[model samples]
Target: MQLFIVGLLGCSLVLSAQALYSSSDDVVELTPSNFNREVLQSDGLWLVEFYAPWCGHCKSLVPEWKKAATALKGVVKVGAVDADQHKSLGGQYDVRGFPTIKVFGANKNKPDDYQGGRTSQAIVDGALNALKALVKDRLSGKTGGSSYKQSGGGGGGGSAQDVVELTDDNFDKLVLGGDDVWMVEFFAPWCGHCKSLEPEWAAAASSVKDQTKGRVKLGAVDATVHQVLASRYGIRGFPTIKIFRKGEEPEDYQGGRSRGDIINAALDLFSDNAPPPELVEILNEESVKKTCEDSQLCVIGVLPHILDTGASGRNAYLDVMRKMADKYKKKMWGWLWAEAGAQMDLEAALGIGGFGYPAMAAINTRKMKYALMRGSFSETGIHEFLRELSVGRGSTATLGGGNMPKISSAEPWDGKDGQLPEEEEYDLSDVDLDEEFRKIEL
Candidate 1:
């Protein structure tokens, strides 16, 4: 009887430890104090999941998602987060819905995964089951390639590669020698969504290699050990992809990705003149001048040519324009600058030629209030005057990024089961606190 009791107690302790690891697997906790420095810096595979609690599809998908964790037992880790609770983060990733999946590995940033439709079993089975072709794409080094299992558990009856075990330490050996597109994924083994996307990333890597016959390279990064690299590159969100050239800087890309999209974005690097799109010609001057003359709140930045004087004037203006551009697009600049350009005559009217090189000036169309200042510029710092263009509250860029899905489509973006979730109505009053306060107080 005593022996039996001892055995039972030992079993209970083991079970308890197992339970702790399993529950913690649900999310990757990052705080100022405690962080997973090991997993962040290590050259292993990590998966990131972006989700929201209010999302019905996300709740439903949780059950089958665990199977992915089970499948990649020794190979990877899984991680997740709640976007509704993390709104600041949600905006950074442009997360339009719940349950966004991302993949990562050694010396690599994160990349999008599990984005399209898949059944419960298929989700659990992961890239191997549904995205084997993607896995193959990575292997062939083309952004678009085929898939075959080279081993490490997600086979689900697919062929496996018993040779060359790709561990965290050896992850580089898989890519360094290859000419193919290297799809190095950085992930944690504890993240479920990461696990789910692993097979897809792997299959995509392998398939791409085989198809392209070694034109591309697919690599992996365990971000746990490489936090410095991740942070330096602004990997505020998981599953980021930094496509590296043979001797150039890697650009950051993630979320809402597809095979064709990844290839197209990266392939241009091989071509000449691949920099971020630049706007050359300023808009037609006279039309803009009249509009600026007529309109209120003309925001102006010093022209780039005025740089010899210094950047304070232009940079302050650029900073404000960058913030405004988040929602208003390029046309706003044409309208805004024209109005500011007209104000130069007013500055001349005031005999203010000795004004600072970099200055921020705003004029009310109706009030014609002249408010110009010289100082350091920040995107968020000048929120007050520009925001006045909106009635009392600011418009959210999060709310305006997409159009409604077509009704004729079978799998539409309905914010429902198959479709992506719609944004919950932000409390108009809450967003506009003064209005609510005024109503109550008066």
Candidate 2:
């Protein structure tokens, strides 16, 4: 009887130990049976971990994984698979080690490996970064069943329209004469590697066009047809990519050939060449209209009066805005500011008066909608606010009047403190203090 009771107790302990997570946790326990239905078919991004119950590293990751799952509840789907028990699923994904984190983005069959830290915050950041890339790919029509035609000179899956065909006739006039930065690929039709690079180049071209606002261009040249231009750049390889800039020697492209790599490199070049967005003061209708209309989203800051915050304080606030503008320059958003009470109509339209000075509102002029910044005015607060908006998680309201507000004309702020109006002295020496008192008494 004693032996039976001990055996039963041991069995219970083993069973409990095998079950690492339960319904109490946010993690969805996955298995081979439901893996396809739950994660493979889902449209949302999934961060799945393949782990073993006996592994020490996997055990440590359990708590952090649960915490990350809770934080990314709605934005991203989090799941776990007991790869030790479900060997079939583990082998399917080639999960040789324990606690392999995979980010299932737009391409479900080929998920990317998560190389971030083991902490919850690191997991969250990685998930958000993956989501952002997915969003960008969708916006560029690279994913969601969109097919790239192989019509252009290259045999890759990119459209001919996107990858510009450069020739000797117009190479110098277009590339060297123009102020825009150029990434030109010299490729031969018979080269196998050049064919593989064509799709990546085409996709990068499409994304770079929108991201850099046409400031950066990607073009391809057939080395065999344009031997003069290719030899000028000393094209020794089959697919040689060169970066061309105004008043500078063409340099070899040292980056990877992947679309993401190309886009990042092009953006780096654009940032080095492009100036920080101009922070304009909203002084008139034209000022507000032009700033808002010129970009995808316009960030408006309603700062305090020059008297309330001296020039130094005001410049500090503007400095924060400038930093944020530089940080998000890739998004190509417009930045504007207005002194409190200087643009009362604009404030009312954006519902900024109730929020107090140093408030912010991001307006999508095309959508006629705006979102207010409820967080602090500091960099961290502003980054959180904008991050939420970028992921389409923040609340927004339609612009008042369904149109741009009537901006009142005002003088630009001078680099000096505001002065109070002088008081006019009045003499009431013979006037009616006693007379009024007597009249009231009567």
The global C-alpha lDDT for each of the candidates, from Candidate 1 onward, is 0.43, 0.84
Residues 1-442 of candidate 1: C-alpha lDDT, one tens digit per residue: 9999999999997656322124545434332121134333334455556676667677665655555656654655555556666554443334666767665442222345555443544544554443454455557874321222223432112223111223444444443433434444555555554554444454444434443333444544446555655555565544555565444555554532433333333333222222222221123444334545534344554333332423454444554565554433312222233112334543343223545434444544444344443334455434454554433232222111132111111121122122245788765654778887899999
The window of 10 residues in a row where model 1 has the poorest summed lDDT is 404-413
Tens-digit per-residue lDDT, 297-339, candidate 2:
8999999998899999899999999999988887789999989
Top of the candidates by TM-score: 2
Whole-model lDDT for model 1 versus the true structure?
0.43
What TM-score do all the candidates reach, one by one? Answer: 0.30, 0.61
TM-score of 2: 0.61
Give the C-alpha miss distance for residue 48 in model 1, angstroms: 1.5
Off by over 4 Å in 1: 1-39, 84-96, 105-107, 129-442
Off by over 4 Å in 2: 1-160, 427-442
